[model samples]
Target chain A: MPSELELQISPIVQESLVHNSRTLQNLQSLTASLFGVSAGILGLESYDGFLFYLAFSLLTSALFYLVRVAPSSLTAGPRYFRGPFEFWAGGLMNGLAGFILTWTLFYGLVRA
Target chain B: MTWISKSITTLGGLLLAHACYSAREHSALQSLRAASAASLTSLPSVTTSLPLDIIIETIVATFIILLGLVLGTRPLRPIEWRVWAGKIEREGEEGFIDGAGEVNKDYMGNPFSALESRPNFVDIRKQRREFAEWVKKGG
Candidate 1:
């Protein structure tokens, strides 16, 4: 079922995959911490307003960690999330989450 | 992102801190909705004046944000490794990784083992190569 264009991984690349796997695990843990902080910051005052914010935060965390960290390196990237979905998605999530949390907090203060 | 990440995180963090400090109610009301007859009597006439609590919160938030901006760009006490290893971003949260995967205790806080066994030199060499390649790739 392999396509002709699908490049076979080299042995060194295989070894690198193991280390990268560990690194990805570390990255996932770090990401969870960041998202938890962001979500708490967003939802701290009122429970109702930031459902999307918190939901997106959790969703992004799960997607990135599962796709990028839990899978084998072959699935992650020939280029380490930079090659495909994770790259842009990761950046977008970060931007949106950061924006919403910050925006709500700032405006919320003004209202207060 | 390079320009805005620090500012946003700092400012956002400060604003978040302010929210934590201010009025007990975090209602989404655009205005003080306790604008009913009895509540209207309770509302101060010069309502535009920022409450002292809000003022203090704002001041604290400002200081925190200013400090974060200043320190984010500057080098404090150096870690075991001089280089920053990597970064991860997701859902608007981004973090940096530096000074990781060390071996020496004096240099990097390793446990007393120098009474220590030999390290896997070959693996380290290979990892070093991959890490070098990672840098070359502009990661």
Candidate 2:
């Protein structure tokens, strides 16, 4: 979090912050279900399934950074995001429910 | 760019569906073989994981779809006010367009436009002089 004094000096654009985070959230949620489908197809169970989700979620973040955040942000620190945590790990919990939903559904569908 | 991402996502979806079907078939076949073998020799039923090709296809399809989605996302804006305002000044609506090449609906250009176009700043005398000149020259 930026200090109040720091924020006063370099104000934040609320709309841009919302737009950037919303874009990232949408991508994360969509890809979480995709990862779940792949995990199900691979017949991952229990810890294996969770691990797959974790690994793929990080991969999604990395790919997003490489594609979207890295080009313009090469000099400046993550201009679109509030902080590193918001850019990277914030979506982990956001998409976990969707991931498990699709994971269980496809897991049962494939096995049956 | 939008069409490219859409086509890539569609191709990935097709690949994922194929991999799912292959895995289902492989599982069904394994169960059938296990059933027959158990009936003949009283052996424990065997369960085999998805084949390597199916796993690879699923992973590859997922990655491709992820790439398409990330590509499809709207362009992000800088959060700091100066950076954001500078971008607006530099790129105008061009920088704020989405993947479909349409300007975003929420894009309100130039936050200080109201200040720049203040009523007090209007050149009423110049406007009146121009109006009088036009009247004198015409009927």
Candidate 3:
């Protein structure tokens, strides 16, 4: 069930969904590569490497929102964010697998 | 055609990866020679190779390039009418009625008669008149 806040905002549109998904994909891929580089440089290992990725992915999501979204209206309409999940924190979960793949590759290469 | 294109793309990607790996290997060998010139005998010669960073970067860059090429080359299919109509209606700030349905219904009953009648020629004189009217009105 959608919350009252979700109802107050404009309904999600297909075009916006398509556009946002493409943007999210680009962000995930770029951030994944960056996370790999940082992890390799920092010499993080095993569990610590994973933790670094988690923290950075969330940070990337926040930064993406602040840079791309927050300047616009928040609660009014489709002119702002796509939806609550996309606007706030869904990018972190979306980026996780890509981040892990790159982080592992970098960690193995650097530590080797 | 799609299958052929997919196969070609796969082959191209493999060739690109192989070419990138060989180029990196050659550069690494050259760098090793340059490093040896400074009397760095302590450096491991036999195991000398491209750094992990470089290898990862080459692979990632190649992958992204190939992915972009594949995606970019794929033919764009026509948008569905409902989706197109919805977009048009939204932009126009109006409700959409399926105009095609009315056309189809009319054409279905008298298909042969409609096919027999040809469309009129371009009305150049009327267009000139409209342009003259526009100029007269300071449009």
Best by lDDT: 2
Better of 2 and 3 by TM-score: 2
lDDT of residue B98 for candidate 3: 24
Per-model TM-score, in order, reads: 0.29, 0.92, 0.41
lDDT of 2 at A83: 81
For candidate 3, the per-residue lDDT at B7 reads 60
Interface RMSD of each: 12.3, 1.2, 9.8
Best by DockQ: 2
lDDT of 3 by residue, A46-99 (tens): 887678767766665565555445544355312434446664566566666776
TM-score ranking from best to worst?
2, 3, 1
True contacts kept of each: 0.00, 0.87, 0.00
Query: Candidate 1's residue-wise lDDT over A15-50, tens digit each?
Result: 233344434344334333343333343333455335
What lDDT tens digits, residue by residue, belong to model 1 across residues B2-63? 24436655675767455554443443332455455346576553333334565455434533
Model 3 bad stretches (over 4 Å): A1-11, A74-82, B1-139
The list of candidate 1 runs beyond 4 A from truth reads A1-9, A21-25, A36-78, A81-83, A86-112, B1-18, B23-139
Query: What C-alpha lDDT, on a 0 to 100 scale, does residue B36 get in candidate 3?
Result: 86
- Best model number under TM-score: 2
Every prediction: chain A TM-score: 0.34, 0.95, 0.69
